[model samples]
Target: MTTQDWWRGAVIYQVYPRSYADTNGDGVGDLPGIIAKLDHIASLGVDAIWISPFFKSPMDDFGYDISDYRDVDPLFGSLADFDILLARAHELGLKVMIDQVLSHTSAQHDWFLQSRESRTNDKSDWYVWADANQDGTPPNNWLSIFGGGAWQWEPRRQQYYLHNFLASQPDLNFHNPDVQQAVLDNVEFWLAKGVDGLRLDAINFCFHDAQLRDNPAKPVEARQGRGFSEDNPYAFQYHYYNNTQPENLPFLERLRALMDRYPGTAALGEISSEDSLATMAEYTQEGRLHMGYSFELLTNDYSAGYIRSTVETLEARVSEGWPCWSVSNHDVVRVATRWAQGEPSDAQCKMLTAMVCSLRGSVCLYQGEELGLPEAEIPFEQLQDPYGIAFWPNFKGRDGCRTPMPWQSEGEHAGFSDASPWLPIPESHRARAVSQQDRAADSVLNSFRQFMNWRKTQPTLMGGSIQFLDAPEPVLLFVREQGDERLLCGFNLGDKPVSLNIEQLGSAHTVLSDHGLREAQREGNVLAFPPYGIFFARLA
Candidate 1:
């Protein structure tokens, strides 16, 4: 692929810095640690690596609340270490994408600190701040994703500061042209450092309703989890005033314009809004964001119909825009545990990976997903995630999926750290450690390698339009066709076997399968699939 087209149909691996690997024995993963594992990432056949935020932060939201946009956090490493990581990653033929959290910054951030210190300052207008109501209440009824009201009382300024997420992560006032320019400056800084792309965090929340109007209440029956708790009261509102403002589109265009200056640089906007899919379509359309992704597939709902509808809806809505699909990430439960009842077999893991890659547009594979790793059961005492701690049991937060990557089963902390890991590596995960799977031919890791390598050869699977076949439930069948090369892909989502007519697929030659499928024969257009099976056939 050409440099500008590298992200098209590319597979990007997301590395959560804290849990990936630790090089300084600081019990946390760093840039050098990622550099050391570049070969392993390259072997997975991914085009790029999307490293989660490593920018200077107070760790209130891990690294999401950036205090310094242009520098790396001391906990992760210095600027020199980051440069070395960039050099090593490029040497391995892997593009590096950094997370850019433009929606907000740490309260300690110079801009936020200055804005909160007084009512009149040069940077005062950079953050979202408004005067309280006549009755000493917040300006509006906006609620934070972390819980409680989105408005934080500032005694010094005698005003309320808007924070759509955590209060410490005060929202940046993107309506201000200066704020947009400063954000673009940060983008240029990273691009000049030889970074390939950026994964924008909460891209839609950059602007909000200028009127400070109260968000209407969303009845309990009309509510769904917005990555926060139903009990948190944040979910009670429709979130109209705080996010997905029309003003965001122009800012996205400006951001895209800045990125376009650097050839081959791409931007993947994270659309976390009330209607995330619609916002995703809007952001990626035209000259706004190069591409965008939402939490539609990231949710716990796992069904053939839902997945088909999501892809089909986006294809219908955005003609020129692109998408990036991810089933698992730093947030939410791991796919193996979320979709599968509890423990998904190695076969199921391979099926999931193959299904994700076969979808149109780009793909993101989380770090430990290759091992068919289930969510680690973190005890309340061991939980480090503030979200999980706030809503225990019913809504166990993201810590389950954020545990350390197990490299060795018998070593200290599963070879994640010499000392105690920040979070305990579950015993269940130890069995699926990298050391145990390294030599196993049928291991999930090897399956991922083989399938990804094979996928690169099929242009239909890599870059093609997807059409859902008329198949029964528990079985997802789709056709991927690029020009004259068409391929029929079938995936059995359940243990119970189901069959489909292959007359629509035309002449077929068995090419790929997760279950070692070799008994492929055309019986007058009636194709048969084994239990929990997957088949890829090139249409003649």
Candidate 2:
């Protein structure tokens, strides 16, 4: 595949650094540790690896609050370590994509420190700084995704700075050309390092409404959205003025133009806004992001109708750009746990793995997803994520999914660390360790590998046009057509068997089925699918 098209329908495994592996016994994962595990990742049949943030930071939001973009945090090893990791990844036939958090920077960053010094300084306008209202209140009614007000008073500048996330993560002033150029320059630094792609973090948050207008409130009855939970006040407003501003398009174009200078490089954007799907369509159009993904599939909603509607909506809106689908990532609960309602069975994991991979777009498989690891139970005192700590008991934060990977079932700490891990590794996950699954042919890990490898052989699945068929509840039927190859994919998401007449599907024959996930049995013109079954068939 060409560099430009390698990501299309590619399976990109997401590795959360702090929880992946630790080489120095620091209880934190580092670059060298990732290099050591490159073989394991390559064996999973993934096209590329998207490593989460490991940049220099104060750990306020872990590595998301980047203090230095060009260097790796000592906690994650040095720049040289990254170079070795990238080289090894390439040698293993794996493209490396690093996370780039361009929307905000840690308050301790040198640029923010300089910008906050004085209003007359050269860097004064680097960040979004606004004057307080006459009543000494915040400039607007904006609220942070983390909690409380979005604006924090800066004593040095005697003004309030905007932060859509944590107060320590100040939003950048993308309206300023210089700021945009600086952000691009930082991006160029990574591109020059030989990374194949960039996973742009919160890409839509790159620009904000210049007017600083207060966002209109959403009716309590209509407050349901994708990213934030209903409990978060950030979801109370429509989030019009703070993010997904139209001004973000030109900046993205500018960034895309820079990527054009380097052939074979790609940009994948992560968008979260009021209408994330629309924003994804807009941000990824021609000459902008190469692929865009949102939190639509990551939410708690899991049904045939919701899944079909989300994919069909994106397929309708995103005509020119590509879509990257992910069922779980570092920020959300593991799909097996989130969608399962209770404990997930092997059938659920295998079915979800096949279904997500069968989608028309590229796919992101989180670190331990292959092993069917459920969300770890994290206690309040053990929680490290501030979002979880701030809203304890009610939300329990993201630490459950961010815990260390269980490499071995018998190790002191599942081979994740020599010292105590940053977050406790649950025994449930330990039981699903890689070593344990590697020995079981019918394990979820093996099923994911088998199906992913088999998927590569089916061109219809990779670049075909998807057409969803009308199916009854708990049954999702879709056809993927590419030139002479037409494939029909069907899934029984319900707990009971379902039968479908394949008479209209045209000469259908079984192509593949996830390991032991019951394939539909065809009798004459009818197909009977067992509970949690998945079937892929080729049409004449």
Q: Which residue ranges in model 2 land beyond 4 Å of their true spot?
A: none
Which tens-of-lDDT digit does each residue in 210-298 have in candidate 2? 98999999999877856566788887888898998888888899999999998888899998888888988898899999999899899
List where candidate 1 sits over 4 angstroms from the true fold: 513-524
lDDT of each: 0.85, 0.90
Q: Supply the TM-score for candidate 1.
A: 0.97
Backbone clashes per model, in order? 0, 0
